[model samples]
Target chain A: MSNISLSAIFAETAEPCLATPEMNRATIFFLIVTVVGLSCGVLAFIFGHHTIYNNTREMPWGMLISTYAFWAITSTGLCMYAAMSHVFGGTRMGMISNRMVWMSIICIMGAFATIGVEIASPHRMLLYNIISPNPLSNIWWMGTLYGLAVGCMIIEFAGIVTGLGKLALVMGVFGALAEVLANSCLGGVFATLPARPYWYGAQLPIYFLTSAFLSGAAAAVLFNYLAYRIRNEKMSTTVHLAVKSAGKAMTLVLILYSVATFWRLVSFYVGGPELGRTAADALITGPLALNFWVLEVGIGLIIPIVLIILSRLENMSMLAFAGFLILVGQFVARYDLVVAGQNVPQNLGWDNLPTHFSYVPSFFEFGVIAGSIGVVAFGFLMGERVFGKTFTQKEHH
Target chain B: MNIEDLEKEKNEGIGSLPLQERREFLKMGLALTGVFLGGSILSMTSISHASNQKNADMDIPSEGQYPYPKHYGMIMRQNRCVGCELCVEACKQSNHVPNDHGAWRTAIQEKITRENSTEKREFRPVLCNQCNRPPCVRVCPTKATYKDPETGIVVMDYKKCIGCKTCMAACPYNARYFNEEKYAIDKCNFCIDTRLAEGKKETACAAACPARVRIFGDLKDKSTEIYRLLHTPDSKIWVLRPDTGALPNVFYMNA
Candidate 1:
């Protein structure tokens, strides 16, 4: 609480905070958006989640779950990359590693904000998740590890800002370890259910880990590009090189991710369980077909890969654009995965049950999704404003 | 069929049954409840084309293998179930399930098949399977839904339920529903709280069924009809979604 402690942590007084007009304007805009979007979640809490959310007995999860997955996975990606770069210091990637750490923290917070509201009794979750913990449950592990990762990331960011290199590196490594485990646990949440054959398998956990890298690298490139653009400044050589390295990582991941998707989709047609095949059909030719083919495959995978490869890390703007498309595509991909996996009715031939259950997210669900994005955007701008010097110093390690 | 031949006969699911035997069973089903009994399609390998592989571990526990002294279970005499849905009404009244929420503790699934221009209608009663290895219990992050050690019935501790609805998604039977009244997930607990706790021997649904469709009792009690019926040799006994490996206590039979 004392000014000395605050100064020691932040490495500066409050006067220099919010000094830049462009930074202030952008930060304020996202802050407002965050408040407005989160209010919808608040509305759901006030008037029961059952009243607001379109999730039914058949399809108990909807868009918010997928959004939470997207944000959490993206955070893991950022944390992993940041930790790796910090460990192998003096690389161009390390130049932007500090910012990546901050963004990772922001993205996880966004994930928490979305999931906190999505569950009806978050208070009970907090209480019993500790007192009556179910270690067998993947969700429990996911929650616990992500919570640990966030704490480590906050302390790590503080170390970075205060010029404590040793402290930062140690905490960064621990944070990344927690995040990677949490990411796998998140995948396990869906993958372990034998009842849902579409999600049941060993591949999803690895698939999700792969996605973390792709999204993380894309986020790094996009954020760095925007950082320069916001200040109306051209990228310095180190920063440019940092972004180019991220673009290269993105390119590599995109190819691996494409192969993973192909195998995952193709396996369903060849000797997979009928229920699983039907679920895959929802993505391939049924209700979710357009989302899978267009947004997830076309924009998220193929286009970004093509763009990144053609640019060859030379065109910064093109790389940034590819990153943006990848993020959009990743968002839709998460939604499609979650929805399509549960599309087929568990009781398929009973009482005229439809082959696929329809789940169109309600307006409040969209609001919650937007709010999570706002958290990321606002945090990104705020980090740039408050820790701009620390991020660009280039003297660490 | 002797016990040795039964063992040798591949577990070909419902498809292995002789046409004459299947017809006799359906005829008995129709005579008892005015409808033919249809097998469940919820299995991972659809019941019609169920694999010949035997999963002995996935089957209901045999005599002396029951885990609890009062291992409660249900037998849906599928042949005897009519689409009257008196069980659903009884459950609603006994459990206080909200009608508008589309939640049901127990319901009947109706299937109509045509052969030679003659339509044969069927009904299969369904409730919480209360699996020996319950998916809901495994996935519940807060131990909100758990198996009662003594009764072996999956019960809900509403106080701990966060209403995450993960249990709902994990359940193969589509049993659990978010009860807005309790602000938690709710499902059939075999009427453990409402009926069994009140010194009743059977569930409200079993008591209300005019056709004797649902038979509920302790699997540990060898004298009970449920125990004897399930242990009967050469009988067609099956559980819904066998491939889920949930080891459901709820069994369906033609007896």
Candidate 2:
């Protein structure tokens, strides 16, 4: 026992080695990328605030909202997976809990930044909501819950970094609950709208939660792989277990979500010529058909699911590819959700209604979304660099 | 008329004077006077009551009753509309709505042919219905757009608008427009600022119309030409999208 204790002490003493020059070089490269991203974001905001984006009377909710939903949902997914691993304790993803907590925090921040710009008067919404609470409003609940979840995750990440496992666990549980509620509420924002019948349903919240999990698992595997490649370090045994566990979770969710999506489309066809049917038509036969089939379903789901299965969840490269595919699919999914819901004319059988209404995101909108991503990547890279010691599993001699 | 003397003579003639006769005579005279006075008073009161009811029913011009001039609403007659673009032109001129791309009002020319080889082509001017239950009002996040309670006209306050275009979605009539340059929502205010405020009888389009297809008036007043025309057997009143339950005030003939 004394020999083991002495060896543990020796291991602890030896593990605080300085980050190598290569790690330094990678960090600097990420920093430069982040700066350039931020600079582009600033320029886009300045030039695009008043012009280029043509969100007219015909098209009210534009590309920004879709992009915002994409980021927000992805963050929720990441946070949920991280919390599940930490709280349950028996999960194969136990070792990478520290890194995931950081990723979740950074991703949520990115979500917030994108949404902040998307809303015309976010400050007004915040201030007015506080002064005169509208509990019935889905948006109010969504914004507030997401805000709380993000705050909790940040605290949990800090606690984990400081080696306070118990506090991190408690905060992690809180964060998971908050994220679950917020993600559902985000779906509820659309579901409660009786005006847009396509969005009105009980299925959305569940669909959103499933997507969140799927996206989260994909993100974890992708980011973990990227981190390993950057450091030129082999993933530890524990991280390998985590990747396998996440792959299984991803596969399961992909199947469930695909089923849900299929039924959702089917119901729209069975239903009659209200806005819901029209919205469904917008997906199946209208301008959005290509995106719906190719990006969201073909690339996002089937391809990734096939790749993950064919690889038997063993190969890191296949897992990473699947994760990338899922992310792209998730993006397309959100785009479809936003644009398709609004594409159907409100006045059915109206003579004066526009024959077809369409929208495509301008360069500025793309820049802002890109900038938001840059912010997340920068935050993650910096957090890892400064606090690399805390993220690693403590060596047990 | 010596009633007392006559009574004495009668008493002399008769064995005994009838005690109830004098009382009967007095009662009869009092009853006669009461009946005469009551009948006159009742007739007078009835005449006055009828006159008052007539005044209430009549569409007399009262100050401050309506926010706009006497004829505030626009009416489109089905027969007279020739599918001409005059009203559309007049609306653009009056509102200064961007003629380059978007127009505030338009004329719809629909041609329907029956199986019997009878063709009926209808020309209708479509603009804001100026709905009594405006959906646009319910959806405005900033409360920048509102319906006038007195006039029943949906109006947009461009300065306060955030250019969200929520109003556009809410408006089933497709009346609202977003100014791309100003980033504000715009639509027909029914020429309220110009024609209605000035106490004019007709809008620019109504005046410019050579066929007199459109009629403008207060719907509440029966005496107004539009109201009378709507109620008359010969007049056919129709409202757009009666199924929408909007209770639109803008009445159209053959719509």
Candidate 3:
């Protein structure tokens, strides 16, 4: 690979599709939203989380935590897919693997930004997480692994951009491994909490990994569709085949995830702790019933699988639309899983407390969630503009 | 009264208890009942008077086998707590906990149940258990909350805390809260820096309590009231949520 200057990379806008004024306007719009959303996050720092957030002593984690998890899981899924496609070169999915790598990086940054604000002392986290490390902590491992994955992915992306194919593949392998381990650690954070019966046990780590693949596959189809649509260009035969392959992966994972989800809920009712049953009931029959039944179950799982079957993986628009709905469902699924686990009080019968605690995310919390979406949106547009050629062309080592 | 007549009578809840009558009950100082009210209520009521109970010894370690040089603990005579909240007030003052935000280092839990047209009320005080294996310490990403090697007391290093609230979720007792002023999670530190560092023997809440319900001492020391109270023959000694396997130092009894 030759030495490529930053100026040369910026000036070399070889792709005609991304040079349009319309694409520029869309990018600017997302940029403005990103600024507004991030400013809302900054407001929490100034006002203090206690005043700005609706999170109570009972429900300490709100919607932001779920959003962070959703984005992180998606990123992990994307990273793994990209690495697999690269390793198994000449597969239909390999055609769009480079684009997947780019989107994965963007999604992880979005995750970081959301969590950076959700936590009160991000600076302390950086400092003490290094100096006062706790090897036993699942959260500690998650943070460290994600950090390593990001570093590897960024270097890998650089290698891809600079035409260092061998370096890219090596770093991609490490990035994928880090991401997979990080994803499991994320699940461990919830699964190992014996205090929270709803989240306890060994099922959650595998459950989260399954979810990562689901979200990853959905994001692949959606982003690929958007890439073509944004450019007002027709999809190449290779790109079409790659998206179709992603659709097939999405359908398969959807079925597996549905089974996993069913058993997860069933296990709670069959001889589990009463507290755990009540927690599951929070989604099955209580306050979160609407979110669970409609968004998580009907929209996120069943409908998407049916749509894919109807389309027979041939209709591009149908596949993309189904992918969009799947993403929405997955988002709501994360929220339901987080909220339901904490709904039942720890000391339920002791205090004169309600059977289930109520938590409503504040306006600022929504703003931060929107801001994370904006980050991904803006990054997608910029990536298309800058790395348009790299994404569209087939790579060779 | 016959069972039919008792069932037919109107059940008066704690809401109907007169102020004078409540005061009289407090003066009487009834010992907490050790009756096990079924398996459903085991999480709320830990003490069991049953002599044949095999699980009673599981809540605590065997006698004279402590993990720390000074295994500090507290025993709450749950029945003596009348919900006066003097201890809560004292905790707030000592710990600098803000009242407006519902930030509490310790609090009272009032349980009212009706059985056969009779209303029964019980007040239970809760604080950080200072578990031998604290979940908060286990989940804290930065070792912000750690068990003091010397005292086995779970303490916080606020400067290292990231305020992730993972520790809060991991705590089985719901004993933690985010301290906005400190920009970190805070909980009952057993007044380590407040009174104990000042050459005092007891915590602020224990000292403020009028009913002598809060007993604070080193459980490793056989002479201390905490150790004696927990070891008394046939005493109904228990700790909350022993199934969590936290091996909490805090004891609840009717000593």
Candidate 4:
């Protein structure tokens, strides 16, 4: 067959295509939302500085830190899943991998944006870190590696869209490796802190990687579903297969993650401090109990798992709802990890310290977090609108 | 040849030596010049001393009282503390810290509820413990946080801080705080610049406490009060989170 005929045959087997008008509308809408969201985030930082919730000396890191970790971990998960799909030549995910790659890149950018506002002096941090260069510090590694990973992934995504598939594959592998190391280092930062017994453990890095896979799969399925809805098209067979495969991956990782999270808490109760135990108790029976049990475990894990199973992992709407639940649960999980880790007092036997240190994220912190989500959503939509054709095999006109 | 010509030829031969030998000869010449300079310096010193003999009449301390003992570490006794806010006040004053919403040092009042329905409340002044192997010092990417070799106090140079709060995470003691307005991390420095360096006897908190629950002295010196307390019966010395291996210097007397 001639090259043109072969190309035509390839195009015939591809999925739904977007019209120019639909693409333009989606791009414009996403751009506007992103601008508004980012503006709100910036305003929150400015105005929230004057608020009472700027994290006092008693509680140095509050909501902002947790939110930053959540976005970063989720981004790692997305990138890893995308890279894994490509590496294994998974035919099911081939249609959505391009879009997933874009999502991963945008999510990481969102993570950076949230962290930039969360930090007191980002410019000074960047400058000093580069000039001094401490290889021993986990924060140094996390920041440097993530920056490289994000750069590589963006380049990889660009290459994929521009038909440089070979270059894209190489960049994708590099990006994925960088993210894995960076995410593990992030866990290492917490694990190495012997002071916070709740966080000090060897399992954190592995647990983080597992959750990343879970969340990444959920995010991919949700984004793909959203793209179909926006384009006013039915879910294609290839898309269905992709969602089903991701659903299976999510279920497996979620179970593994749940086990790790359970034992992590149990270990704290068994050998950790009464103060640390009390902090853990807070998760099971204290103020955070509802968030932990109801949102994270119930809605986030159990319900999603059951729904995915009942649907035979084929129902698009059911799976999307599961994805939403998982994302919410993941957010709570991040919050619980950060807040619980610090709630325990250092002076365990002392009678003079406060009963419980209180922390509630200021409005500005929330705004910044919301704005980061907006940035990710905006990026995803814009990428789809511009390169939607590349994300999937082209369908006949 | 005449004697002058012979001397000149000998000097030329010396100059014609290999480079290493010439360098050795140059070094010897420099050494001789240095000796001559030293001799001249000694002579000039004696001459100047003779000319300024009247200034030598200034009082000089006896040999036994000449050099003072060096101060190394500080200690705070729990029993002697009266919960006076003097240390907190003095810290703010000494550091020129802003008065709005941050504190370099704070006093926490913990109310204990006993199992037998008894209630007891105690006030504990809290600041950076100045750990020997400080986690904050280790975690700072910019090395903005450091431990003083002479005083053994962990000090933060605010100008160098980027306010990442990694130090905050690393500190098991929850001692470090970020100054929101200035966007710099702040913690207790044990008043190194004001009290310790000025040859003062004690920290502001120890000196100002009317009940005398605080003691400030060198832990290393055998004669110092801290060493005696550390060795005394029922001393019950404890450093926060010994498991952390920070080797904190801020030893507490009672739980």
In terms of DockQ, the best-performing candidate is: 1
How does model 3 score by TM-score? 0.91
In candidate 4, stretches whose alpha carbon ends up further than 4 angstroms from where it belongs are A1-33, A44-54, A347-354, A394-397, B1-71, B106-121, B197-201
Fraction of true interface contacts that also occur in model 3: 0.85
Q: Give me the TM-scores of chain B across the candidates.
A: 0.77, 0.66, 0.78, 0.65
Tell me the alpha-carbon RMSD of every candidate.
12.2, 17.6, 15.0, 17.9
Q: For candidate 2, lDDT tens digit of each residue in A1-397?
A: 2334534533442223336776567656756655664454455345544354545555666776777777788888888887777777777787776777788878877777666665444545555546544465456577778889888888886566554577778888898888889889888877655556677678888888888988888888888787777667788888887888888888998899899999988988875436788888778878988998999999999999889988898899898899999999998898899888777765544444553467887776676677677777777666656655556664111
Fnat of all models, as shown: 0.81, 0.10, 0.85, 0.60
Over A1-397, each residue of candidate 1 has an lDDT whose tens digit, in order, gives 2234765555552225446776778788889889999899999879999999999998898899999999999999999989999997777799899889999999999999999899999999888999999999999999999999999999998777766778888999999999999999999999999999989999999999999999999999999898778767788998899999999899999989999999999999998689999999999999999999999999998888888878889899999999999999999989988898788988888788889999999999999888888999999887877786777768466
DockQ of 1: 0.58
Candidate 4 global Cα RMSD: 17.9
The per-candidate count of clashes, in order, stands at 0, 0, 0, 4
Q: Tell me the lDDT of model 1 at A339.
A: 91
The DockQ for candidate 4, computed on C-alphas, is: 0.30
Best by TM-score: 3
Model 2 lDDT, residue A287, Cα: 90
The regions of model 1 sitting more than 4 angstroms off are A1-20, B1-58
Best by lDDT: 3
Q: Model 2 off-target regions past 4 Å?
A: A1-50, A86-90, A120-136, A163-178, A194-197, A344-355, A394-397, B1-255
Residue-wise C-alpha lDDT for candidate 3, range A196-310, written one tens digit per residue = 8889999999999999999999999999999989878789998999999999999999999999999999999998688899999999999999999999999988888888988
In the order shown, the candidates' DockQ scores are 0.58, 0.08, 0.55, 0.30
Provide the TM-score for each candidate, comma-separated.
0.90, 0.70, 0.91, 0.81
TM-score of chain A, every prediction, order shown = 0.96, 0.89, 0.98, 0.89
Worst 10 residues of 1 chain B by lDDT: B48-57
